[model samples]
Target: MEDSHSSTVYKCHLLNGEHVYLKIPYSNVKFHRELEAYELLKGRVSIPELLDYWSGDEECPGAFLLSELKGQSLTREVSPTVAYHVGVIHASMHAIQPPSSKRLNGIQNEFSNWSAFIEKQFYSFAEDVKEVLEEGLFNQSVEKFKKMNQQLPSPDGPSFVHMDFRPANIIIDGNKVSGIIDFESVRFGSTEVDFTKLYRDFLSADTTLYQAYKEGYNSIRPLIDLDVVLSFYRFIDAFNSIGWCKRRGIEKNTVFLEENTVRLKEFLR
Candidate 1:
């Protein structure tokens, strides 16, 4: 089966012809992190059961795994109910507090406080666009982000968050969410971080779905200052992405940077 990005996934069939996904990662570090995440999340969430994993020798220097998960990637037909169910599952995942030893969140500690982490991340990335961005606009954005960061209170809890939770990552069997794949980006962080995709991307695009998700989440674990938190992290993510594109010299992502900038500004307001 052809999955996305740097993974080599093979649909390996057994003697009975039953198949399991064998995932091999390009980096040993990523391989170990993902293996740990799967081990941590097993039976807690609707995810693929980790069948086997091998941390190869120095000669090979990589890792691979076999696992089984039922259902396919969600295509076009996502209704409000599906969105709501996704929200509920997401909340359940967030409720789980992982061990402190887990350095899971993608960010590698630039700042002490999580809120400061958000501001520092955006400012660091916004620096990449200094030459391209107008001086006044850039300064204005900086001030706004600073103010927003100042107002951010301590996070309620640090929970296990699937940093890349989206439609493509979720698997559905009929109306039920059978499993969520792609644990490489899994981490422990503010629960608000998990809502960025749903609120900023999915919910913003569909009001009915947004309402249903809100209802579902509130029924399980209601979020406080949702709009503010969503905006805060959305802005941080946009700027971080912009910085990454700039740093990597990926000109193709210019449009993406611009779009995120606009969204970043909206959230800043």
Candidate 2:
């Protein structure tokens, strides 16, 4: 049976009629990363408790895991209050300072110097935009971003960042968030990266949500040069999305490419 989102989710009945979520991964590597992240963060944060994971077979290298989630996704129901709470949750996650040894591979190195880190990781993306996208408007926007990148502010500090912080990854029940899922993209970077997704994708130019998120973040840790950090990641994210869509052979992402190009132009200005 298909869920509302058309994802093939299985229900495993546990003791007392409780059910565990068994999500089948699309590929072996994705399964491995998802399971690895679940193991890394099971007891460390408010995530669905992971029970067990197993690979399907040699011919079919995909895998599945049993997890317990107490709430539904917040993407279906979003409001100003939910947005505020999402910000609070995001801030709390970033405040969790894991040991250096515990950090992810690329993230650990980046924590030492975020400016160089972003430049190193995203410079290739800029090149991809130049090569793959032949549109004059997009090319102009990319060039403008390259020049504007010199003026962006540097990171003030390193924090635990949920690189894919968005409504689909957050689970809510009643008025409280029950779980935050999908940590495969977790990294040690500026929290502003996470905030940018919330602000741009979720709030739709609503400054109130941005303010609420900022208040929540400031309550936990102060932000310095946040606008610059947000702008940098926003550009990188735009580039990454276009690259990803191309790699996945998704033609529909042309719209996203155009949208992000315009957004990058505005941010550069």
Clash count list over all predictions? 0, 0
lDDT of 1 by residue, 161-199 (tens): 777776667887777788788766665667767777656
Candidate 2 off by > 4 Å: 1-19, 23-36, 55-64, 75-80, 100-108, 252-258, 261-269
- State the displacement of the C-alpha of residue 56, model 1, in Å, after optimal TM-score superposition: 4.9
Q: Candidate 1: deviation at residue 138, Å? A: 3.9
lDDT of 2 at 268: 49
Best by TM-score: 1
Question: What is the C-alpha lDDT profile of model 2 across 1-269, one tens digit per residue?
Answer: 24212124577787798887777665565566566566555565678777666766876545456566677776634555766777677777777664656544333425667667667766666656665666775566667657766876655446667777766678887777787876555666666567666656665556676676567666766745565566666767777666655654446567766787666666545
Question: Which pairs clash (backbone N, Cα, C closer than 3 Å) in model 1?
Answer: none
Worst 10 residues of 1 by lDDT: 104-113
lDDT of 1 at 203: 73
